[model samples]
Target: MQGAIARVCVVVVAAILNHPLLFPQENTTLPDQDKELMARMREHEEKLEMEQAKLEKELSQLESKQEESSSEDGYSWYFWSTLSFVIFFTIELYRVDLTDTEIKPVEDEDVFSESGSVTPRTMVLDKDVLSNFCDKCMYTSSHENWRVREFVEGFADDLLESLRSVCDRDADMEVGDFVGIGSMFESWKVCKPLMCDLIVPFSPPDPYSFQFHLWCSPSSDVPPGLQGCGKIKVTKFGENEKGCLCGSANMGDDMLCLLHSRNDTPKVDHSPDELLCSRNTPFLAKDQVMKWFQISVTKAWGRISHKYDFEVTFRNLDAAGALTIRFRSGKVIMLNIIPVVQLEDTDAYFVSHFPSDCDSPPDPYWPLSFAVYEKNLLKHFAKRLPQNSCHLHCLQIVTFLHRKQTGLTGKSALTNYHLKTALLHLLLSKKPSVWGVESMEHRLRDLLSFLQRSLQEKRLHHVLIGNSKVPGDVQVPLIIRKAEPINLLRPLVLQRELHAATVRHFTKC
Candidate 1:
């Protein structure tokens, strides 16, 4: 046993001496060339190790540089600029690309006119393909829309009827008409026709009413969060016996027409002197009215929901106190029942959750909403469209893009409402012939180009508010009318580079 152990120990010692990993010293008895070769191999390993460490350091530096580059697209100086428009209606639409010092000048727009197309491009998907695509999409959507409309009309009739019966107890809490709105209601809906907009008019407490109020400078008392925007107020009131400013003269016609399109002037004072405002209304919290609406609307719908097969849900109360209703059948139907007042003779409009004012009382009543009048204008645009025109098609496509990219609704910034505002501007700027089928692709490009230019200027002028183009009777607040427009998507410019991509693809088609 001792002999066997001794032999094994000797074998282990020899193996350790022979092993390259465990033994550091090399055999000195080798030839000179072999020794030189081994020295060269060791030098080679040392070089590899040095190279790897250097590469690791360089990789870390590159990663940091990439992170910094990513942040550059996050902001632009245009966001903080003051809005300006020169006297000529010919706008110098431009962009200040932060990444490039050299900008490609836009083709001279001075060459174009309302009556003619721009220098015709060798654009693809020309007239025929575009017209056919629009038709098929419209045809596909119309049936679903008809069914949804029929269902909603039935639902609204029963709902408003129930509201009228139970709402008699509280005069201020009473809801007036139930009118449908939005793209779905207007029949321009594309892929998803699941939502519906309904206007539910609320009667204001006597004497007090909603109007546009602009804040011109610092020291002006505006809404709590809106102190930074001391530019203009779209709200204004005229003198009357009840201390109420009727937009008719008091209710000024054409004043509120910019936000939404309307032809008829206001004829009646919805709230007259004999109908006194409620003394019980709260001053500080207009939300109290929203609370009133939430309870009154939900309970009112409860009495009527049984008549329809769908489930009625009061999803949320918006900042202005508008109530959102979600109807669930096989699909979802979103109904926005907004309380509003159309200004008397002036034809301006206001919503129930009173717009926050600068000079007015700290407490609020209904502000203003122009949804109905806006939709009314949409109807006019729809009716006048040439056969298979791209106005509705273009609107639907952009609207879908807005919803998909932002997951937003009309209430938010860059809403379908804003898109409509852009469309209205284009409609008014050019002749109906300019929106013909052959010009569909260019018209779409033109709208996107218009938005890009406006964004770069940091001002998307409110259509209802005063600007270079608004009517005389339309009294938008000086500060609000002139204040820098909201740059809601300033930080998100990259997430939606789709506008350029859209033009590129369509032009190629």
Candidate 2:
């Protein structure tokens, strides 16, 4: 150790002497300050030489057996070694802190986007250091990602295959009886894919029909501009559900005769306020569809070999309607197969039901979802982007911190899905160059600031809505074009006390 220190000092001194910054030409003029600085450098060099000499003397003493006897009399050497290692590891993780002072925040515009975006200032963070930190996180998270996805998705495929085999014989189902339609299927998810969102589309027997419903303030007249809610209209009602427009005299001609028009099948007793469709009460009831999935999927899962090596067995199906895929290996994932409706043009009806819905609306039209389109939009935007674009790293970093501070739960105001939407919108606004890895800190600050502004304003336009900047060439519903911006953070905004709480959360920073 003494010899290594001596060699390091020699190299540093040699480099300083050779360094161009240290030299001044004979003809060059120098201020008194410059002269004093140069003198200080010379003194520093001399002091280093003296220190090196003292180190060598100590090394000589240690080489002698007398010093060895003194070392043996002290505490264990590994104690100091472990302490040094912990310190080294802590230094490496310094950048992971959200409040790292190197990030210079850009000012956001309070007014709507008129001309340009918030221009980020060039930050002075060490490029190599930031890259190293991100690389380390990504390496470990990638491994955890695979285990959850592999186990969950493998089970999903087998389940889907079983549904296909049965649906082939069961003439009542077609086109929409699918499951597991969200983020778990995507490759960009980080850490372990802890949760899965499954959407089993309700295939109401034909002639019953379905139409998309926009939850616009239960008022008698809707605004012409349709602000606050979206359109879900042929563009809405399923092709077969759109009768006469599907180039057929009867849209139900090819469909099964399970229409409520006939009295052959008895109607299941339901409460009057339960939002049953007036035209077809028996066939396409949302609650009944949910009940069917709960029973059938559970039965199918039970018939499969349960005592597998990985030990994935039939966990109970949720009462409200979703299949829960549990794992005996580890509590790494929570998978749910949800029952949903597939509208040709699904609208933004439930922006108020964020985090998680507090109340179930008495509507027969099962609210539609745009999970498929969102994934496609992200996948397309990422195609030409550089591998290390901060467009991704910003999200990965923020999400890592978010999970640490709170968690990946619907109970919180923040969510990974919201972050994903923010990134998509930013991609639409900013040029590709702005998302480079070098701009990570600035980009991340920008996203946080944007979210902060959204929370304050109580307005976060749905990505599927045509109001915000939609990505080029991505098809969206026409109703989305006419929809007014909704207050997605309304629930959070309603509580005055939460403002202080939100401020505290934002300051984590």
Candidate 3:
């Protein structure tokens, strides 16, 4: 029975040694079993290590994906955030401030007067009283007033000095020859005793008659015969009366006597012949005087008359010759004394034939010559005259020259053609006159040249009218077209040209 117990115990010991949980065993003692157990543990450990490695790799991949997603989201957010900030900033910058601010009130007393209510001081500035006051003050303070006063005083002193010099210059004249006084107004009374009583009696009135008599004497103390130094009788509607017979006697005889008396009344020691010789000599001669005079007279008459309608004749007489004046109204006056003369031969000749038939139809040659002279004269004067004066003269010359050119008497075919050509050329030049023959020829040539060039360019061409046998070269229409090479190879082309031929074609249709 002890041997059986020993076997069971051996088995129990073996089983206890093979158990893995048992800690007191030596493992090398069982070779195959130990090898097998070690192989299983090694396999399990290798499996666990591989599994951990795979898990770690998967976690790293997941982390990398998360980080990439976060970076992309951050970039997107930053882009959107920057754009939104810029938009907000721009909106803020463009916004307007509508806030209210305080304003200080203006003081009324600074602009207004100290009346109980506001006075119209500013409005009164435009009033006449204020304006006049300001004007007066300005005038008083200006240099013009002082200058005017100085001029007046100097003029008065100069007049007195000139009179004294004149008296001293003429040694033959005594102090009594010239009665000097303080003023012309005061001298009248002082010389009243020496003055003559010239009585003018009213007479029968007539529409064309003078109605007054004029008388002059040296002193009032003289008797009838001695007082008759000068006497003139102006009668109304009598055959003996030679003076102009106006219907009225409203003016005193003193004023009329001077104008009515003949030049012979102013008698001196020098004879009319000697005085004429001295005065007739001309130092300067001017042909433009009549033009200037006409201009001035026209302007003056234009101001006075209804429409510058009047007739004036300029007469030049020899200083030594007998002067006989005749008026449109059968009044004649004769003078035996000499007059100052500045007559040019041309002007004198023109004046000698006074009141020529200038209004009548002009001679053909005269018109041409006149036109030439007038044009050249105007051009010459234009440089010397003021702008306004030159313009006025130009207008006058144009009117006069136009009249002269159009008012020729002869109307022959040759003359008509010449005039037409001249006028056309003149019109082209756009100058005031056709003045000179040379200038007219030049302008005519220029016009012909222009027309020739125009014809060559097909801009203008002559056409024959009526059934004349003349054949003229008329302008022909030229057309143009636009097409590419490919299109050009096709059938038709379309174009149009502006020409006389087109016009004629339409007219014929």
**lDDT agreement with native, every candidate:** 0.50, 0.52, 0.28
Per-candidate TM-scores read 0.51, 0.58, 0.14
45-114: candidate 1 lDDT, tens digit per residue: 5665566566556556655654432233323212211111221112222212321223333344434445
Residue-level lDDT tens digits of model 3 in 1-509:
33223333443444333333332133332355577787776566566556656655655565565434455556655665566566555544443221111122335434444432222222112235333533453333335434433433443333233333433222211111111111111111111111111101111112212211111212323223221111112222334656444324545545554434534332233221221111233111112222322333334333433422223232332211122334456533322111111111111111111111222111110000112122333344345434433232222222232334334532111121122222323342445343332243344334434433332343321111111221112111110011111111011112223333322221111
lDDT score for residue 147 of model 1: 88
- Per-residue lDDT for 438 in model 2? 71
| Alpha-carbon shift of residue 37 in model 2 (angstroms) | 8.3
- Model 1 is weakest, by summed lDDT over 10 consecutive residues, at 80-89
lDDT of 3: 0.28
lDDT of 2 by residue, 262-370 (tens): 3444333333223223234432444454455555565555556453444343333323333344446555455666655555444212211122333433323334356
Report residue 64 deviation for candidate 3 (angstroms). 99
Model 2 off-target regions past 4 Å? 1-130, 143-151, 163-182, 216-288, 310-331, 345-362, 407-411
- TM-score, prediction 1: 0.51
Winning candidate number (TM-score): 2
Query: Each prediction's Cα RMSD?
Result: 24.4, 15.4, 42.2
